[model samples]
Target: MQIREARADERDALLSVHRAAFGNTEGEAAGDTIATLAAELLDDPTAQPVLSLVAEADRELVGHVLFTPVTLADQAVQGGYILAPLAVLPGVQGRGIGSTLMRAGLEQLRSRGATYVMVLGDPNYYGRAGFATGHQIKTPHEIPYPEAWMAQELVSGALAGLAGTLRCANALNAPEHW
Candidate 1:
């Protein structure tokens, strides 16, 4: 398996992966909502731009990860991007595709001078990737799961003085999705 930047024409495959990887309350496929979130984040003018990555095996796309610009309360110390949504095909969930994509993407961001990366996800899962239960930051829009809000600093002391409401891309401003 290999991870690389997603090509412009592979949007649909990414969407399908999201659909297959995420599920609704009943444990059934509920991808349309997240897929829409992905599309909106990708296109929103207010978004700080994004980096999308895909994990491919045997020439088939199996997983995806995205990073979008996030604003911090202290404009001077930008929160960098938030890893809003990460998806791996249901059939490949435990195979480490998602982890590989995540590590690669974060490394690329670090190499690019990123200060921090945040996410709203399961602590156990994100923790393995160095995510911790502390952001000392706020979201631009209100989010219901404060516990899920987590962050990992790429630069030393990046989050040391960071605090404030996080302003996410327009697509991720929806309270319902949070």
Candidate 2:
């Protein structure tokens, strides 16, 4: 398997993988849509310091991960990012594609001077990638899933004494039925 930045032509295939990987989960349909919009918006020229990576095997896309700008309520802390919609095709799960995508994406973000990275995901999965609960860092986002809402500091002391709501690019509204 190989990992690389996603090309324009691969969007649909990546979306297909996302749908398939997350389709059965609760609230995933709308999450998938939001993820797609986030990816598209991040590609806009005006967007700064965004990173999206994909993993492929035998010429078929297998996984995707995205990182975008985020901020703490305190203006002093800048260059934060959010990780969302990490997806690996069901058939490809447990093959390390997700981990590879995350490592590469986080490295790229750190190299670009990102201060911190936050993710809403399984603690066990993300914890393996160096993520810890926001409470550990005093994150302001009062995330409902305390355990699932996590953050990692790329730069030492990046999140020190910081607190604020963790808002997505667009104040994402959950679907009515959810």
Candidate 3:
């Protein structure tokens, strides 16, 4: 399988992958919401420079992930990013597609000068990819599952002394997303 930045025309395929992957776990309505958020995230002014990637094999899009700007309430802290809506087609869930996509995405973010990355996901799953319970990080958005809220430093000491509320991209600011 190949991992790369998704093409503009591949938006629908990305949505389909997320809808199928998330729908199985959270019902069709939640899937639909994520798909909608995918589109909205690209257009949201507060979410400039969005990173959207896809995994392909045999000419089919099988997995997808997105990383967008996350800011500290205090402007003094340089803006970081948050990973959300990561999805792999249901037919290929256990094939390491998600992990591969995540590693590649994080690498790209680091090259772009990003110091850290955050996510709201399963500790068992994301921990293997390097996310830890963000002890020094915080978010204003009331997360339903705090333990799932985690972060990772791309560069050593990236999270050192980091504090205050995290402001996610506009499309992800809604409480339902957490």
Candidate 4:
């Protein structure tokens, strides 16, 4: 197994994994939109610094994880990230590809000086990676799934006294067609 930055040629395979992983909830059409948005967002200058990691086995893309710039308002803090669209091929789920990608991604972000990271995902899964509910920190986003909205402070005291709306990258909020 090898984990590395995804190359341009691997985008389609990665999209296939994403579609298989999220298609049930997001629908097949949504997968195309997700892939398109990911491609467009990757080219944006402001989002260029974000990281996209892919896990491959035998030269086949098996899983993917994306981290983009995010901000928390209370501390006027701006050096964090948002984890989105983490996906693994259905056949490979529960075999640790997702965990591996997440671990590598978080370590990379911390090494890159990211102060914190937020993810909207399953608490049971993400909590194992050091994520805690945003409610514990009084995060400003009134997310419907409270347990799903989690935050991890990379640096000690990174989130101390911080409480604010998490600002996602423009790409996420942009019109679907963009």
Candidate 5:
């Protein structure tokens, strides 16, 4: 398997991976919702400076992850990114594909001078990637499972003295996404 930045032409395949990953658990509607969010984030102006990565095995796309800009409301916080809609094909779920993709994405972000990356996901899963709960920074909306909202400092002391509500890209600002 190989990991790399997603090519523009692979948009449909990327969405298919997301659909299959989420569909297996929450039905087609849930899959479609996530797929649509991925699409919107790729196109949304507010989501500029985005990072999209894909994992391929046997020459087919098997996983995908997206990182979009986030900010402290009314303040300038450079290098703030949010990880969302990370998806790996259902057949490849347990093989570490998602984790590999995440590590790759974080490395790329770090190379680009990212200070931190936030993710709203399972504590057990994302914790393996170094994210932690109890961050001082708040999400744009109240999260149903606060423990699942996590962040990791890409650069040492990235979160130091940072405290405020986080503002995600417009495509991810909806309450349903929280």
Candidate 6:
């Protein structure tokens, strides 16, 4: 399998991956919601400078992950982003496609001078990717499970002294999303 930055033409395939990945565990509506979130985030202007990556095997797109711009309420921080809606083909879920996409996307973000990356996901899953509970940073809306909100510094000590509500792209600032 190979990992690379996603192309504009792969938008539909990328959304489908989200649907399939979420539909298997969540309901179809849940899948559709996440897919719509992905689509909206891609078009949201505030989400510019986003990092979207895909995993491919046998010439078929199998996995995808996205990181969008974010900001701290009081700090003029640069290179802060949030990871959302990572997806992988249901048939290949057990494999490492999702993790590979995340690692590749994070590396790209770091190369672009990202200071830190945040994610709202399973603590165990994302923890393996270097993210830790991020209570120091806040989400736009109150998150029911605070433990799911995680962060990782791209630069050493980047999270030091950082504290405030995280303002994400408009599409992702909703209460339902959190």
Candidate 3 lDDT over residue span 8-83, tens digit each: 9998999999899989888999789998888889778888789999999999999999999887887676648899
For residues 13-125, could you state the per-residue lDDT of candidate 5 as single tens digits?
99999999999989999999999999999999999989999999999999999999898977787889999989999988999999999999999999999999999999999
Model 1 Cα lDDT, one tens digit per residue, 1-178: 9889889899989888887788632244357788878878777888756888999999899998989888775477654888968999887788788888999989999987787998888888999999987668876666676777789999888988788888878788888667
Which number leads on TM-score?
5
Quantify all predictions' global Cα lDDT against the true fold.
Answer: 0.82, 0.73, 0.89, 0.78, 0.94, 0.91
Q: In candidate 1, where is summed lDDT lowest over 10 consecutive residues?
A: 23-32
Candidate 1 vs 6: which has more lDDT: 6
TM-score of 2: 0.82
Q: What is the lDDT of residue 122 in candidate 1?
A: 85
Taking the candidates one at a time, how many backbone clashes does each contain?
Answer: 4, 1, 0, 0, 0, 0
Highest lDDT model number: 5
- Sort by lDDT, top down from the best: 5, 6, 3, 1, 4, 2
Top-down TM-score ranking: 5, 6, 3, 1, 4, 2
Q: Which ranges in model 5 have alpha carbons more than 4 Å from their true place?
A: none
Error of 1 at 14 (Å): 0.6
Residue 81 displacement in candidate 4 (angstroms): 0.4
- Reference-based TM-score of each model: 0.92, 0.82, 0.96, 0.86, 0.98, 0.97
Query: For model 3, what is the error of residue 102's alpha carbon versus the real structure, in angstroms, after optimal superposition?
Result: 0.2
> Is candidate 4 or 5 superior in TM-score?
5
Please list the residue runs of candidate 1 whose C-alpha ends up more than 4 Å from where it truly belongs after superposition.
24-29
lDDT of 4 by residue, 70-138 (tens): 765555676788787688887879999999999999899999999888887789999998998744443
Candidate 4 vs candidate 6, lDDT winner: 6
For candidate 2, write residues 1-178 as lDDT tens digits: 8888888787778777777787745467854775565556556553445677889899999898878787654455677888866888878799888999999999999889888898878899999999997544433434556687788989898777777655445432232211
Name the runs in model 3 displaced over 4 angstroms: none
Residue-level error in angstroms, candidate 2, position 55: 0.2
Q: Is candidate 2 or candidate 3 better by lDDT?
A: 3
Task: Give lDDT: candidate 1, residue 43.
Answer: 78
State the TM-score for model 1. 0.92
